[model samples]
Target: MAVVSAEPVKAMKEGQILVTGAAGFIGFHVAQHLLSSGREVVGLDSVNNYYDPSLKQARIDVLKQQPKFSFVKADLANRETTKSLFAKHRFPAVIHLAAQAGVRYSLENPHAYADANIEGFLNVLEGCRHHGCGHLLFASSSSVYGANTRLPFSVQDNVDHPISLYAASKKANELMAHAYSHLYRIPCTGLRFFTVYGPWGRPDMAIFIFAKAILEGKPIRLFNHGNMRRDFTYVDDVVEAIARLIDRPPQGNPAWSGDNPDPASSAAPWKIYNIGNNRPEELEHVVALLEKEFGRPAIKEMLPMQPGDVLATYADIEDLARDVGFRPATTIEDGIARFSKWFREYQN
Candidate 1:
């Protein structure tokens, strides 16, 4: 694999940075971090009802107070609107985080996946392609490791066997991005995130759902009979990774060869990295932490594993650490405590 450049890929000073899906969980945090660092940011989102529009609105409302942050409510699937957005701002760098994001949901609503994750991403790529983007970072998911029983999935691993449409769409994004980068020399980086959870997390996620169920004294379903593990990365850690990576775009590997191509890097300026906690915790252990934080016992309901679900997910983040000079160190105990505090407050 080619070594990533240590130097920053400098963005144009004239235009504001673009963060798609800024109303969503990770995007919101990324935009906030960029704003705090004094970068003018244009946050775009459809504010779709994937989970709850009110929660999305709450995030947008908070960002509205920041002087350096501007919000644009538009669907990336709308090509004209997306085209106009690019023509208007001519963004120097884009953090594309918006997507139709649910594995189980994709089985029922595959069109949504096609519309958002596929079509929406193409629009973002078009914008970056035409507007002279300095760097383009987009979200991929650890779910792409589907059916692969590897213990600490690495970027070099082949992910051609995604079990769900959601994962397939993300894999497609990586391929699409590689094509754009190869053709246009666009510096593209794909981030494969693990199970991200924290304050302002999506309600559909296990942590949030389990917390809500436990609070209401309802049964929290344990998939695969409570025999599953996940690299539950905290959202703050994810944001920090993005902040560090924003400036360090990949310089194409001159040593790369097509005879034995690496999955994580290419001769073009395209790279993929897994940003995860690197610590896989049992689902039961996470439940125990939540129980301790809430001072209540959870009603456990062991159930069969749902379709389009994996038994475990662990990330190999050595590449990320070596390239970015950081690693995720937050313990699940600390993360759960903080999340519990915020969940309690948000409930009121």
Candidate 2:
């Protein structure tokens, strides 16, 4: 369920909520959802040319219309700038979403991951630590599951063997957050997001790329020879999950034991949740849905498995449901149809 209809589980904390990467796909939706619920939001973005600057600007332009929304354009990698941002705002809760995303891109440009994901994340932690944030919720990735072959990846799964630099960076964020939470007592929650797709999605993502190719009568590349599967969670579902979790910060488990430590929770105010569809859908099936929605046939190009890419990703959202009382429920078919409608209008 979207936040538009669902009542907020907890009232937002006083003062403006700081949402980094507000121009980005998921961040934009998160910011929008918060603003819709009568909350003041400070949206920040570097507006880099990761995909298309215009698309990011378009998202910002929409957010600008909200009287309660304020926009800031700054690079998170810059320590002084990020510090200044936190000092200026003194945000009660910080939703750190800005990062150098994409597993494949990390292979070509390893430095970017270090700059944005690692260095930038550290800056966020320092800010939250010194500035007194009530809760720090940051985006992690299912890619952190690396070599683990477990179906329906759980938050408690050991994620030490990340295959890609991007995944490693995300894992690093989780560790960094946990340490801060343990040492400084800042409440932190890490969200391991699966394949997030919807309106205003990244141009580099499979659904966006395939949508363009299918409409233009071009062949769509299916990595892993069209056999890959993903827990495709819609953007609204993700925003809903985030909206619900904002007020409910983690209170460290008293039962947590160092002798048999649980990877998902800590003795400190730290926790992790896998926010995904909890149902894996095949790559072929996703394309079929797109074709059905757009009323077009796709030309297929099967390719061997790419480096730093997993064969499948399924989310074990039991922890999220138990704790937050929510799980991503949008089916791939429904998500594709909604995406196709938006793509048509956006393309025009």
Write model 2 residue lDDT over 133-202, tens digit each, in one string. 9889999999999999979798878999999999999999999999999999988989999999999999
Error of 1 at 145 (Å): 0.9
The lDDT, on a scale of 0 to 1, for candidate 2 is 0.91
Compared with the true structure, all predictions reach lDDT values of 0.93, 0.91
TM-score of each: 0.98, 0.96
Worst 10 residues of 2 by lDDT: 1-10
lDDT of 1 at 299: 100
Q: Looking at model 1, which ten-residue stretch has the lowest summed lDDT? A: 5-14
